[model samples]
Target: MREVEVSEITKEIAELCQEANFELGEDVINAFKDGLENDESPTAKAILEQLLENAKIAREDRVPMCQDTGFTVIFVELGQEVKLVGGDLEEAINEGVRQGYKEGYLRKSIVSHPLKRENTGDNTPAVIHTKIVPGDKIKITVAPKGGGSENMSEVRMMKPADGVEGVKDFVIERVKESGPNPCPPIVVGVGIGGTFEKCAYLAKKALLRPIGDESPHEDIAQLEKELLEEVNKLGIGPQGLGGRTTVLDVNVEIYGAHIASLPVAVNINCHAARHKETII
Candidate 1:
């Protein structure tokens, strides 16, 4: 069996948090570039340009891409054959988040309570999701989600009979209602099937996918493509000033349903799609 140090995982998470905040991923940057090229509105083109320039400045200055910085969310895939040494895995992850947010000069956006809303100074206690995979390597992905787009997400339980059309309609309607709230030219992540919680999990997972990637199943892939076209047709444009670049992409992931239930979730991402991953 392979043995891995928990401290190493902690250290890697810290670095990833900092790196992800400071730099935009190549996939996301390219998405914006492509959006700009296809953007029909002058305002949207300008917004895309500004976004590109901001990314460049953030990297050059070693500063965060956005002031929000975002709440720390980590997805970990641990190998069943590996044993963790030296500490509790979850605690180590939290320590990494604390140190990363503090030392990296990233803003702390987590709160001790959702209703009372007490800011958790260190951005500690990251929202960690761990999965056991069939390998010896531990993979971790950090996605710092800001409030602007997150607040616009929605979830619903559609009747099994409602089918794909229902999902398309709901997502499009929600995006239209969301309009400029999600910062426009967004990335839409849809999760279909599974239970309520599982659907939400899938929705978030969908966001980690590279832009323009689709589900392997042909039907789902077509659904993703169709959703992308429909969302862009909303014309929310860049920063909601009206244009053809309302959505950079739409990603959908699905699982077998209960035979009686269909759960759907929508996770929206702003123009600043800040994420990074590391394996240790």
Candidate 2:
């Protein structure tokens, strides 16, 4: 088995945390440019332009795109054949987040306790999800999720017979209820057919996929297309100022569920869907 150092993981996470906050993905930037070109509302078009400019400035200056530099969420794909050496994996990850947040000058938003409401000082105890895969390489993804869009996320346990129409209605309704609160022109991640908790996890994980990339399954891809069209029709526009670009994209992730249950979850990401990944 190959040996991997926990310190390396820490270093990688620190770099990823900084990079994700500073650089908006090319797919997101392109989406804004496309929105500017196609949106008919002058106000929406201006907003799109500003968004693009903000992204450029963030990258050039190595500064966060938004004031809320988000809670650090890391997705780790560890190779089964590789063994971690030197230290505890989770602790190493947390150390990385602490160093990253402090050194990068990103906002420290995590609280030490839920009810106590004390700050964590540095953003430690990052929300990490680890999976074992077949290869020898480790893949790490850092997605800094902001509170505004996350607050707009929802999950519902639906009857088995509720079906596709039910899901569409629920998602649209959630977006309608959210309105400008989650920030408009959002990316909607829909998870269907899983258990209550699994559905929520899937929805959050679905946001990692690039905006324009459709699911491999034809049915799911079609659903994503339909949802995107329906959501944009809401006239939420850029920053909810009223226009045809209500959502940048709709991504649907699905799994098999119990015969008696059909659970659905929706996770929303704002215009600055900041994430970065590295393989080691």
Candidate 3:
């Protein structure tokens, strides 16, 4: 068995936290460029240009692109053969968040309690999702999710008879209602199947997939394409002013669900689309 130190995990998480905040993935940048060529609305094209400039500044300056540095969301694929050593894994992850936020000069937006409204001070107790996989290495991805887009997200528990059409209608309606709140030119993550909470997790996880990467399943890929077309037709535009570039991409992730239920979730991310990952 391979032994991996928790400190190593902490160190990597720290760097990822900062890197995710500062960088916009190439896929996202390319989508913005494509929007400029295809969005039609003059206003949409202008906004897209500004977004490109903002991304450039953030990367070169090594600073966060958005003021709301976001909740420190982490995804870890841990190899079962690798034994964790040196410290508690969760604590290590949290400590890494603390150091990363402080060192990176990122705003700490996490609250200690939902109703109490107390700030965590250092962005500790990150939202961590860990999975055990077959390999001997650990994969860690940090996705900093802003509140605006997150607030616009929703989950609908539908009867199995409702079917795919039901799911499609729900997603479109949610985006239409969201209208400018999640910040236009958004990336929509749709989760089909699974239990209610599991679908929600899947939706958030879906955002981590690179933009434009279609699912392997043909049926699922078709759904993603359809959703993107219908969503852009909404004419919400860039930043919701009005145009055809309302959505940059749609990513759908599915998991097995029970016979009686269909749980669907829609998670939205704004133009920043900040996420970074490392394997160790």
Question: Candidate 2: lDDT of 51?
Answer: 89
C-alpha RMSD of each candidate structure in angstroms:
1.0, 0.7, 0.8
Better of 1 and 3 by TM-score: 3
Show pairs that collide, candidate 3: none
Please rank every candidate by TM-score, starting with the best.
2, 3, 1
Off by over 4 Å in 1: none
Q: List the residue pairs that clash in candidate 2.
A: none
Candidate scoring better on lDDT of 1 and 3: 3
lDDT of 2 by residue, 57-89 (tens): 999999999988898999999999999999999
lDDT scores for all predictions?
0.90, 0.92, 0.93
Q: What is the lDDT for 29 in model 3? A: 94
Check candidate 1 and list the clashing pairs. none
Candidate 3 per-residue lDDT over residues 1-280, each given as its tens digit: 8999999999998999999988889999999999999888999999999999999999999999898889999999999999999999999999999999999999999889999989989987799999999989999999999999999999999999999899899999989999999988999999988998999999998998888899999999999999999998998999999999998889999999999999999999998888989999
TM-score of each: 0.98, 0.99, 0.98
Model 2 earns a TM-score of: 0.99
Model 2 / residue 63 / CA error / Å: 0.6
